[model samples]
Target: MNRNIFIANRLREVLLNGHWIANTNYKEQLSDISWQQAIQQINELNTIAALTYHINYYLRGLLTAFETGKLEISDKYSFDLPEITCKDDWDKLIQDFVKNAACFIEKIEQLDVEVFEKPFFDEKYGSYLRNIEGVIEHSYYHLGQIVLIKELIAQ
Candidate 1:
C-alpha cells in the first residue's frame, strides 16, 4: 500500500480499532471505564482522564496543523485538562477524543505520499513521518499507563 494509507493504518491501530500492538486501543479502553474511574488519582501517576486529555490535545493540535499549516499547540498547555466533574463532562471529552482521532486519521490518509518526507510544520520537528510515528508511540506509552492504572484501580 502507499505510505499515507500505511501510516493512517498505524495511527488507527493505536488510537482506534487495530489491536495488534497493544491488544487494546484507546477507544476500547476509554470506553470501558466510568467517569469516576477515569478521574481517579493513583499515587504520582496521572489520572486516566488527564492522560486522555493529554493525548487528545496533541491529536487536535496536529489536526489543526494539517488543515491550516499552522502548529500552534504548546507542550505546556497539553495537560491542562478541565475538571471532568460528572459523567456528562467525561462523556464529552471522550466524544471529542474520538472525533479528533478520526479527523487526525483522515488528515493523514489525505496527505500526499511525498509529504511524509517533508518537515512537519518545521524542520526542527523532523519529517512528517517522524511526528506521526511519535504520536503512535506516545499513545502506546500512555495506553500502557492507562491499562496498568485501570488494573490498579480494580485492586
Candidate 2:
C-alpha cells in the first residue's frame, strides 16, 4: 500500500476511535431517567449536561469554521439544538452531534496534513492540529465525566 494512503487510513481510524470512545461513555437513551434524577445528589460544581453539550458545540464550531472559512460562535446552532425535555430529544442531539463530528474529521482529511500546522482559525489557539487534538482531548475528558455521572445516576 502507498505510504500516504496508509497514513490516511490511520488518520481516519483515529477519528473513528475518538468518536467511538466518546459515544461509549454516554449512551443516548430514548427512555432515560428523568433529568432531575440525572443530576440528583450531584453537586452544581459538576456540569451534568454541560460537559457533553459543550464538546459537541466545540466540535461543530471547529469543523464548520475550517470547512466554511467562517468562525463560529457558541450559540450559532442554538435554534437547532434539541430541547431538554424527553429522552428522544437527547438521542436526536447525540445523533446530530456525531454526524457533525464525523464531517469535521472528513474535512480535515481533505486538507493537506501541512494544513494542520496552519491556524485553525483566528482564535487564540489557532493552530489547526492543536485544535483538532484539543477537541479530542477535551471530548475524552468530558466523556469520562459523563460516564461517571451516568453511573452515579444509575446508582
Candidate 3:
C-alpha cells in the first residue's frame, strides 16, 4: 500500500473506529453520550460538546487548507463552540464532524507522497507530513480528555 494511503487510513481509523492505542476512537467515545451529558460541566473543565467542536474545527481548517491551498484558521476562534440547546443541535454537530472527517481522509488519500514532503501552506508551519501527523496526535490528545471527562461525568 502507498505510504500516504496508509497514513490516511490510519487517520480514519483513529478518528472514526477502533485504533491500536485505546481500542476506542472519537466516534466510539462520543457515540453513547447524550446531549445533557455532552454539555455537562465537570469541575469547570470543557464539556464534551465543546471539545468535540474544537477537534472538528481544526480538522475543518485543515480540510479547507487542502481544498483551497490556504491556511485561514486562527486559534483565537478555534474554541468558539456553538450552544447545544437540544438533541438536534448536538446531533447535527456530530453529523458535521463525521462528514468533515471523511472529507479530510479523502483529501489526504488524494495527495501524492511528494506533497507530504512539501511545506504545508508556509515554511514556518512545516511539511504536510508534519501537519498531518500533528492532526493525529492532536486528536488523540483530545480524545484522552474526552474519555476522562466522560468517565468523570459518569461518576
Candidate 4:
C-alpha cells in the first residue's frame, strides 16, 4: 500500500472508527451522547458539540486545500461553533462531521504521493505530510479532552 494511503487509513480509523491508543474514535465517543449532554457546559470547558464543530472546521479547511490548492481557515474563527438547540441540530452536526472526515480521507487517498513532499501553503507551515500528521495528532488531543469532559459531566 502507498504510504500516503496508509496514513489516510489511520486518519479514518482515528476520526471515524476505533483507534489503538484510545480504543475509541470520535464517532464512537459521541455515539451515546445525547443532545443535552452534547451542549452541556461543565465549568468553562468546551462542550462536546463545540469540539465536534471545531474538528470539522479544520477538516473542512484541509479538504478545501486538497481539492482547490488553497486554505482559507484561520484559528480565530475555527471555534465559532454553531448553537445546538435540539437533537436534530446535534445530529446534523455529527452527520456533517462524519461526511467531512470521510471526504478528507478520500482526498488524501487521491493525492499524489509527491504532494506530501511539498510545502503545505508556506514554508513556515511545513510540508503537506507534516500538516496531515498534525491534523491527526490534533484530533487525538481534542479527543482526549472530549473524553475527560464527558467523564466530568458524568460525575
- Whose lDDT is higher: candidate 3's or candidate 4's? 4
- C-alpha lDDT of residue 48 in model 4: 91
Identify the runs in model 3 with alpha carbons over 4 angstroms from their true place: none
lDDT scores for all predictions?
Answer: 0.94, 0.57, 0.89, 0.90
For model 1, residues 14-100, the per-residue Cα lDDT tens digits are: 889989999999999999899999999999999999999999999999888877989999999999999999999999999999999
Best-to-worst TM-score order: 1, 3, 4, 2
What is the alpha-carbon lDDT of model 1 when measured against the actual structure? Answer: 0.94
The estimated TM-scores of all candidates read 0.98, 0.68, 0.96, 0.95
Q: Highest lDDT, which number?
A: 1
The per-residue C-alpha lDDT of model 1 at residue 105 equals 93
- Per-residue lDDT, model 4, residue 91, is 93
Q: What's each prediction's clash count?
A: 0, 0, 0, 0
lDDT of 3 by residue, 19-51 (tens): 798778999888899999999999879899999
Q: Write the per-residue lDDT of candidate 2 for residues 1-155, one digit (tens) a residue.
A: 53334343443443334244344433342125455543344665454445546666776776767668887655555334333666655556556666765676566567675776777677586777676666656655766776677677777
lDDT of 1 at 133: 92
- Highest TM-score, which number? 1
The residue pairs found clashing in candidate 2 are none
- Model 1: how far residue 31 lies from native, Å: 0.9
Q: Ranking under lDDT, best-scoring first?
A: 1, 4, 3, 2
Candidate 1 vs candidate 4: the TM-score winner is 1
